[model samples]
Target: MTTSFETLYQNLQAAVDDELQTLLCHHQPRLLWESMAYSVLGGGKRLRPLLCLLACEAVSGKWQPALPAAQAVELIHAYSLIHDDLPALDNDDWRRGKPANHKEYGEDIAILAGDALQTLAFQLLSDPAIRRPDVQVRWVAELAGAAGPMGMCAGQVLDLHAADSVWKEAEILDVYRRKTGALIRAAVRMGALAGGAGPEQLQALTGYAEDLGLAFQIVDDLLDLTGSFEALGKTPGKDLMQDKKTYPALLGQAEARQKVESCLLRARDVLFSVPLLQTGHLLQIAEKLVHRET
Candidate 1:
């Protein structure tokens, strides 16, 4: 039988897919448009954008107004992935079952593409048609915090340093939270702020995002162990090869799964304090994330 989480995930996925298509079609550049489109439109779970939309809905804001922000979050995510696949980083040869951006387009173009996408995210946030200047500034700051030295970038540095070293579970969580969870949390906060959430509401959603983000990383770790390339759409077992710390490495597989479940439950509990009707989709997403195969 299909679970409620699966049903909600499909609905959110459809919405995110449509939004991404519309945004990509509308935005064009003089050069490397094709590469930019390929990077942005590549197949992956639209988790960041979905979080934006859900956070908007959770705070009684019109979700439509946050679509641009959602697109911006996704652009940032795409940029990170593009850079992550570079030879200097993960050295990945494939992504989503296709040649890596650097491999397909050449490293120079791939780097430029990522740079352009990162800038484009700010442009999207600043578009006068989409958001007020104040909101734009706030959202841009949030994005910068999540993507720059103090956030995802820092996490990546930690990840590189930890390679071939034994790391405690806390250290692993610290790295994942910064590298992965920071942007995820930013996505949620940006959506909530755009949706007119007050400080209190934002606080609750922040907690929810934290739990959800950690659970996401844990699930990713689990998939690396249990999934195949066909199902994962990327190389599995790469973490093990790299000797990177992961939830499953620190905690046993069974314990890691339990941790994910616990995190999802905590996320749900936090969301439950809000009006159930307002947070239904967000709650559904937290549950669905834990159980996703890819």
Candidate 2:
């Protein structure tokens, strides 16, 4: 099953890469597209898009139909990362083992690239090939709500406050849900919806995504303190240097590790409740994401 999953993942990853490059054409303004391409084409796991396709397969057994939705989520993710690494934000210079977009391109170009990526995401969903206006509207709204001011943006605001205030566990978790989990939830929800999931099935998958998203963040928190620059593909100790309130900071290494384990188990149990024959991939993804070293 693992070997089969690996093969399937590689196939799907290749398809996403191809379509992503095809999405942005070589147009009159060369620099705009170039800056956007720099970060989107740069190396990363493509986890959100893969999760969307996998969720679709679990529901409909036809991931290909959900490919555009998968692409949309990835574009939104790429845009968020670009903005997150900007000087006014996280102020990081490295991403996916390369210079951040703002550094390689000028800050002005990087900002515009991020904007283009964000709007293009909606453009992809709005494609007539999707064949359903309602679904298109829902997808556009889903991605927007997840990435918009009330979602990831709201989380960013809370995170900035973490630097100055000592936070309770709940407070820190609130930030994680907004900063990391909202888009993850939207990815799974959009995929399942595209796959024609019923209410109960959608509920189950949503529960799974919420738990897995929290676990993913906790693991990232652990990695930031213990992982190396090479393994992480970016500076690892920024959280500490920035005095960012993270799970490890509040619970310590042992407790934080245990928290991740609990979340993963809950995610798995929630996934199991979903009546589907093809949930093996989502289950594996939850385990792999939480247990990943880099």
Candidate 3:
């Protein structure tokens, strides 16, 4: 029997949502909690969490063991989004078809909520339910490295400055790798690591993720031009408005799309080169995301 990717995605998404609610709800200071929940529970494709779970299954034939890691990645993603949409950052209102968190709540509350969500991610990864002390340590290190200075943070800073500057392809790629690719690669790596993958298996999956990550970012840039606000569940053309550096901005639509295809081809080839990877869902996800409007 073939596993339905949409079904698995829905199921995993529900599980992650439930787990996040359980972990986040019922805390003190109802307003702060509400803001945090608002930021996370706002609808968006749970891509990072799904990648974490599916990568674990691909390596070990089980996704359940990586649930906590899935939640952690999603939380980290939510935190990033909350801050990304702030006044001093991307500076536009509306996320997921509604007001951004800072707009819905006050900026002060939104900032605190993002901070809390960031810490909550570590809390999820460090919980006793993870069942392995060393694994907990490793996940903590991986996620932190991915989200911290040299990874997503650095990318965002570089992107901020580059908004008003010109960047070559390599420089643009560096920002994309750090800003978007780092967490994505980390999500896959943490999942595979949780599944106890051998070094070769880890290396292969990492390669696939690297290529997939680039494709994902390029697609995001494409969607900004091609997707409707209703379809994207966020404002489109923000990139153009800010004059942000992106593949489409630098490479032209035809070349940027070609790059996306090239990246996807390499991603699949890396998966093919490795043996013993039950990564059908991962492959499906790459194809789906390449064509995704949201």
Following a full C-alpha superposition, what root-mean-square deviation does model 1 have from the true structure?
2.2
Error of 3 at 229 (Å): 1.5
Clashing pairs in 1: none
Q: How many residue pairs clash in each candidate?
A: 0, 0, 0
lDDT of 1 by residue, 193-246 (tens): 888888778888999999989999999999999999999888999999888888
Which ranges in model 3 have alpha carbons more than 4 Å from their true place? Answer: 1-3
TM-score of each: 0.93, 0.97, 0.97
lDDT of 3 by residue, 107-200 (tens): 9999999999999899888989767998889899999999999999999999999966768999999999999999999999899888888888
TM accuracy, model 2 = 0.97
In the order shown, the candidates' Cα RMSDs to the true structure are: 2.2, 1.1, 1.5
Better of 1 and 2 by lDDT: 2
lDDT of 2 at 226: 93
> What residue pairs are clashing in model 2?
none
Q: After best superposition, candidate 3 residue 221: deviation in angstroms?
A: 0.9
lDDT of 2 by residue, 253-278 (tens): 99998999898888888877858758
